[model samples]
Target: MSSPKILSVDDSRMIHTLINKGFAPYDVQMFFASNGAEGLEAAAKEKPDVILLDVTMPVMDGVECLGKLKADPALKDIPVIMLTAEAGKENVLKIAKMGVRDYIVKPFTEANVIDRVSRLVTLKPKSAAAAPAPAAAAPAAKKARIATDAIKILVVDEHPAIAESIAKAVSKRGWKVVPCAGPAEAQPHIASTVSSEETPDVILVSLAFPGKGALKFYQSVRMNPTLKGIPMVGLSVKTAIFDQNEAKETGYIAIFTKPLELGELPDRIARAMDLDITPIFYSSEGDCQVVSIPQDLSETGSIDLTRQSRKKVADFVNAGFSKLIIDLTGVTKFEIPLIRAVASIIHECNGLDIKWRIVGDDADNLPNLPTVISTNLKVAALKELPNPFTNTAPLDIYPTRAAAAAAF
Candidate 1:
């Protein structure tokens, strides 16, 4: 079978990351464009099997692009999916009138992208592809795993591997994870907990639970007077809009779309359960304060990281540390949210007169972030980001933590 060609026309680099990661297991020929005008040019040339077109973009917006696509008989035949936000009802209605095959909302995961595209094209897993896939597991780092086991989490899913992955990730924060095979086994355990007056702190249930058992479980739990308000977080595929809505209406505390950001899961659980999430990203190295950035940072996660780092930076400065090392070595996705956070932290460091350097690489796009940031000088996301930190520029990014520390 020929590799399916997929074109993404979105300005956000993070969307590219999503597509790349989600489709990593498949043999796909993917193309990307920064805007709609560029998209038209690429679509004309590449002639992909499908196009994932964003609604709002620079140069030409999705609406205009769609109009042009339809106007041109050759391009009009290719299936197009609209990328939009939930709030853009008028535009969605307009695009629907234009006969789009489907639409995906903002803040979506690769699961959403794959689900939609699969409807138009047959997606084959890479395992069944013609060539053998080479895979490697990174060596696990020794982290300060779980200070205490005060919080008990119940993870109910059809797949034990998934439940185990969630367990291993969240267990780092010292939360006790109870994995249940399905609603059948989970109910008995949940019931037993109530008798002991020790019900779980939070429940993570799959929205795609076999036999729609997740909804049944949620409703049963909600209707139970004893466990009426226990926090319940729903895990769902990106395109499960109906399941998500039903989960919301049925009173789910939060809904996290899969593939789950395991790095951010602990923080989300902390917020939902009202647990004190001491920053796991901070450390002391000799006379320097080392800050490690999380790899999977969401918009809200970025805000929280900045807020947490601000307090830590002050504490470290008062402790007589003269240098700050903002580590971005593991970060590959440099979305707008993280950019805002990094800029804010750097700006804060400047105000306190602390010398700081970033630890990252060209591959992760860290070295070029400050350059792009300097362009929009008036944006409040980083008022001081454009200004010179030294005589050179707003940032001094190094290739490694040792190099950054040595330079400072």
Candidate 2:
């Protein structure tokens, strides 16, 4: 009958505050520690049901603390959900090897924290049974709105107001909207729906916090064979070219700015999920082959772009073309993966004794590329294309180029 105790080990006061606010609705008791050492000591005294561990800290880091916790006989069995900013595959594998129950990426919403913790401990307080009877009817009403054959859409956003508005808009079309506060909550929902008849037709994830769990979630889903093909759209408040590019690089089908045009969302979602969407167009000028990338390069589009680039480069080389030009003039924004794809094309051209140049505005510098190849204008890049081959310096100076090019 005692309340379930939960311990949070993090260096950030803001994260601690968010956790408190997130779990306030539940019946659990909360404890906090500023570092891994303090957290280990607190865990021994409190014997909490769950521990939320942060990866990066001033004192002992989360990974070291996790190893120590797992090694301890008394605390080893206690479920630990890691809170981390590092969403890379290598990091996830490392944490998983440490035997943590689960991990949630940072900049998470209240619902995200609660969703992960609830999986490990009883979150509802004993007082939950005393709630008014009328409140129980809400679930039935929600269930009625979702027809068994309806298109299922998953909307993940941290802000309650924004999430609700999206849910309301999508529900009007008779589609079922499964709204989640963050990536942690979204993952479970996505898994549960996979085998069901109403599996999501499209998924909309918020990019409010770029490197936080959103990109990580997208990466995780893509890695899973069952969930990889689903269309995913990114929701954002950012209008900067680089921000949009970052979202695209994560392989979102489309990036829509907030406050969203609810009226157009349904149509966009349909188009994204449509199998008959038009392919990216290619044109030839003189000896150069120019490919124009789509404005919204969704997951499918990204794959197509890569495939088309390879085929085009091969075809152009066979036709005796001397250069390949990726006309990104129409592309205001793009993802990191796209850049890698372009780099791959350039590498292929190099082997074929041909040259390649990317044409785009220089307001935002391309990530993971060296200055030798990048230029502010198409004319400048075209003129300088032959300079690298003329120089005898080792390509080691552009270290990130080959590594980034091979990443995808």
Candidate 3:
């Protein structure tokens, strides 16, 4: 099929620039018009697939332009999306009755424009058409993470409330959030702090900002040579695939949608920033180095466990710890990654001539144990394992942490 054609009729140069950036990754023919009169001319000449119309214009306002388009049988069929800053009831009602495809409020992200336009067109990725394919290289391994000090995160959002909520949630991990209203406020922040001790390690942006700030914020951030390599994360509504895809194209390391899954954000940041995390999973306890496994051993977490084993392996030897305790007291589920991770860590420790013992009870002490993800075969297989009460050989079974410690 031929490439889709789109036209934007906005007076603001920034909005036009933002729209272009939004569609930069797509295989589409873009047309621009500075005002309503120019939009009518362009729409007539190009017979575009869709038109993004602004409410207030010098020559002719959107209300008048839209009415004329609807009246003309040739152009009436074309989809039109209204771009407006004001959300007044009268204006909304007026435009609502006029049969515009949709309306996007200003201070929106490039993702927002892509999301709206994608509803009307099948967006084809421009990867092949835009750039020549390069030589393939080995996929980079995810670096082990550690948080020595606070990982400063810059949260750029229109709403301070949302940023504050995220701040409260992640503060426990020693991640500090610097909240800003928009790009304007964020500029000064980066200016003063980029080279300082408080430089941002990651940026979290709300794609649904108030006016037309998100796109501008992204542009300003990207324009800087120093910050070009910094990782960005897009925060958008869950249903907005286009926005998410746009973010992915623009090199956002992660796209977290609302309502945020409060559990996962920190992990993404940790991986992106690649902080040192040796202390999080392992600690020296008495004469043993205790490896505390998380309750839910996600695939990523399992991989991280293996990657992080390098540092603690030597630390135990250096500190003269004689025993390695695999503390699975908190683990309630059994997954392949978790099993593999434990086995790998055991091997690592074994290489150094250090002995390791697990500090966990049988099925009774561990509640809701599963062999893997809810498969009947796996569940049945797990059920056959002997409980502590029914075990024939009670070798190495520890009743408590004290018992485990005593055995070592």
Better of 1 and 3 by lDDT: 1
In model 2, residue pairs whose N, Cα or C atoms come closer than 3 Å (at least 3 residues apart or on different chains), thus clashing, are 27-125, 249-335, 253-298
Predicted model with the maximum lDDT? 1
Which 10-residue span in candidate 2 carries the lowest summed lDDT? 396-405
Candidate 3 lDDT over 1-408, as tens digits, reads 889999999876556666776787889999999888999999999999999999988999888999989999989999999998888888787798999989988757778889999999999898664565658865687454466556788998788887887898678787799998777788875663467565677898988765535656777777766677667888899998877787677677788788876655666567777765557778777777888777665555566667778556755654545588878875655665555556567666665556777777554533332222233223442343222222223335465566778887
- What is the lDDT, from 0 to 100, of the residue 36 in candidate 2? 95
Q: By TM-score, highest first, what's the ranking?
A: 3, 1, 2
The residue-by-residue lDDT of candidate 2 on 1-408, one tens digit each, is 788899999986556766776777778899999899999999999999999999988789999999999999999999999998989999999999999999998757778888888777777744755776674456433231212236788888888787787777767457677888888887776664467565566788888754556788888677656667778888887665565677688788788889887765654565676532222356676546665554444443444445456656665644546565654544445444344445456655665556555555433543223443343213432332232233323232112222322322
Better of 2 and 3 by lDDT: 3
Q: What local lDDT does model 2 show for residue 66? A: 92
Per candidate, the number of residue pairs that clash is 1, 3, 10
Top candidate, metric TM-score = 3
lDDT of 1 by residue, 1-408 (tens): 679899999875556556766787887899998788999999999999999999888988888898888888889988999898864778678789997889988767778889999999989877655556558765676343222446778889888877888888877667778888888888875773467336776899998876677889988787666677678999999999999998888788889888888877877776666443435667778788877776666565666666666666666554546588888877787666667667777776776567888887655366666665565445775564444334334455788778888896
Instruction: Please give each candidate's TM-score.
Output: 0.46, 0.33, 0.50
lDDT of each: 0.76, 0.67, 0.73
